[model samples]
Target: MAKIAGLAVGMSLALGAVATPAGAQTIADLQAQINALLAQLAALQGGSTTTTTACSFTRSLTMGASGADVTCLQQYLQGTGHFTFSGGATGYFGSITKSAVAAWQAANGVSPAVGYFGPVSQARYSAIAGTTGGTTTGGTTTGGITTPGVEGTITVTKNPSPASGVKLYEGDSMKTVLGIKLEAKTSDIKVERIRLDLDETGDTASQDSAFYNKAVQKIYIMDGSTVLASSDLNSSTVVEESNEISITLAGMSFIVPKNTIKVLTVAMDAKSSWDSTYNADSWTVGLATDGVRGVDGAGVNQYGPSAAGVFTNSFTTEDDILDSATLAISLNSSTPNTQQVICELGTDNDECDNLEVAKFDFKAEKDNITVTDFVLDIVRAGDTVATATTAYIYDGSTLVGSASVAGTTLALMTATFSDIDWVVPSNTTRTLSVRFDIDDAALAADTFVASTDADDTTAENSVGNTVTATG
Candidate 1:
């Protein structure tokens, strides 16, 4: 009975060690179950169980390097509180981007953190990425991958000229001549600098620096009612050799949001002191090809005229725009009356200094007129043309000019006055009286009449426009 009980005990011990119909789990099986439960828990919490892959840079990056990789790097730096430019992550690696990379390297304890991104920085970045839990999809960092196509583009078009056919006066200020339209695609764009081309297209067109300076005293760029930038025409900003005008808005920024168009007006202050010879000159202002420089939201440098191509790169105004002021002249109603004069018989000539011969009024319409010279025609009867020796012009009893008569016969004669400076104020009329010195030889009865030819008068305004007279 003792042997049988010992056998039953041994059999019970062996059965306890063997597999049962319930199929109990081993240590490995229990561990796998726990992992599966943890994965499920991670999913519920909006996380991945596997480690995510971060952006990897194969080659070194420095300033001027641009592409998807650079954008990715910039985005990464921005996420890590390194890149902090206003426009966010642009694909181009500029000075600002370089500084950002240097900052990231210093934070990660990388040696010689000089703004340059090399293999050492990439290895460190990769190590950190491996420990992160997000997965990459495209190029942007949703989880670990960066969003694709982050770098935006721009389309440039020439806006219509506001003063296309309108005449621009020399003294006109803030006259809009050309317009440029920039359309941002996909993301916002910040324009940094712009270039313009000036083209003159008339008989009196000139490429002289002085001419350009006088023609365009001040240049202004405007967006609606706001002024974006401005510059006075100078050798530094306006280059005569290239016919290029560069306007850099260093501290100022012009931003065009995604899918929006910004129209920039190019206005100028037409100086009132250009050479009068350029009165018939016409000028056209336009945008230069590949002249617009700016950064997109992805920090990529964008140059234009991108979409419009070279055909629409510039906008031209109509030719034959006059740069002059208007002045009108008319004869005064109180003109000197025609009369006969008696001469002494004993003298070889009779000198009548204050004999008023003619009177005329000069009216300056738009600008102040400076009458420099005049020619008066004298008609006489019963006396030789030599009877009138000299003629004088008086402005309210003040002598303004004097001229000598020339001729031999009594038919007709002309007295010319040159090199005189007489200013006629704008919007005001000045009545001038003319008197003649008549030499009455032989004591003969003589009659004299004086008249001024409107075309023979010479005058100019402040803007160099020759004044045409009419009565």
Candidate 2:
């Protein structure tokens, strides 16, 4: 797309006739050196020249018109180059004077005699004035006349001068009107709308107004410019519009099938999660509800001693006390023992349940019990059973060890005596304890059944006694 080779220079004038004839030279000194060599070839073909005389001949013309019919066919075919006018002299036969009268009637072999002027174009303007040589009005030598001069006018203002200008390329036929028409494309050619005034400092003229649907196949419009407006947009239904965003026909539907591009992205507020203000009491109030009856104060166990031994009862009152309970503590000694039960509930006073009933249950047996020194005075309680109650130490149901009790004796206590590590669970005969009781209202300890006056049913002297094993 780079062409600029226009350097034409040809000047001539030699008409002779008068006076004492040295070498002659006078038809007014050869028509003033043929109007100063046709005004220096109409200022070097910027355009203009005309003159015509028919019958006895006389011709001189230069025509290459562009706007306002280049001053009306440069004043009608300046130096009448035997007729060639398509645009200038703004007599508007625009299309660069029909491509310079179809390139001067296909370089004079004829046939483009279409519009503007007729009679085979005035008989090819009297056959370019009978062979162009100019001069006559009596000193007659009209043999086949060809004076070819006197038609003058040339005006070319350069700047993409092929008339109305337009040439962007890349798959050209942008829907027609002399084709290559454009609504958008900064890279793949095709573009119009006053050539976007030629890149007005890069986008943002309010984003150039809008109307670009050119049947969209791959449009990115804004700056990255990657247009392919339909070669049937492949890769499964392409529809990529983006001055910031607009996409349709994504995975496949109306057949956008050639090389695909359906991308849309531009809602930038960091990436929107939407909170223009968000209402409806912000999600109504914790949601899921139902199940309350501590003597029915309506929903969430509403206030005061909500049942489960309302005040105290070695702990007993169940409907799954909020669904999880098991608190067993037995300690009967017949001399084959190891004992430790430091279960404390919380509300702080070293917690054993100082009325801070949010939840607790205890378990203890070998939370750290390993006594095997002499074997016989072991009465360890808590064999796997605790949902919450601090004092933890079990091995049969896995808790392992913890006992530090004194937040003021756990506010009011029901279970203390903190430290112990008794391990004697081999041939038990007494000591079968278990502990657990979840929803507490301050220690109402239950699930305890002890037995010691020794009938010796050995499971290690009955660990905490209740011996019953058969399997």
Prediction RMSDs, each to the true structure: 20.4, 35.1
Highest lDDT, which number?
1
Tens digits of per-residue lDDT for model 2, 1-471 = 111111111111121222345744333344333333333343335443344333321222224323442344334444434233443245445444533443344334344322233456456645554344332322332222111222211111111211221211122222111111111111111111110110111122333111122111232211112222222322343223343222221111111111222221111001112122211101000001111111110001111112331211010111211112122223433222333333455444233332221111122232222221111121212331322344333434554344332222222223332224344432232232323222232343322221222222122212233222221
Evaluate model 1: give its TM-score: 0.39
| Candidate 2 Cα deviation (angstroms), residue 467 | 63
Estimate the TM-score of every prediction.
0.39, 0.13
Tens-digit per-residue lDDT, 344-425, candidate 1: 4323445565567778888876678888888888887764533778889999979998888886556688988897878888
lDDT of 2 at 405: 26
| Model 2 spans > 4 angstroms off | 1-41, 44-471
Model 1: lDDT of residue 237: 66
Best by TM-score: 1
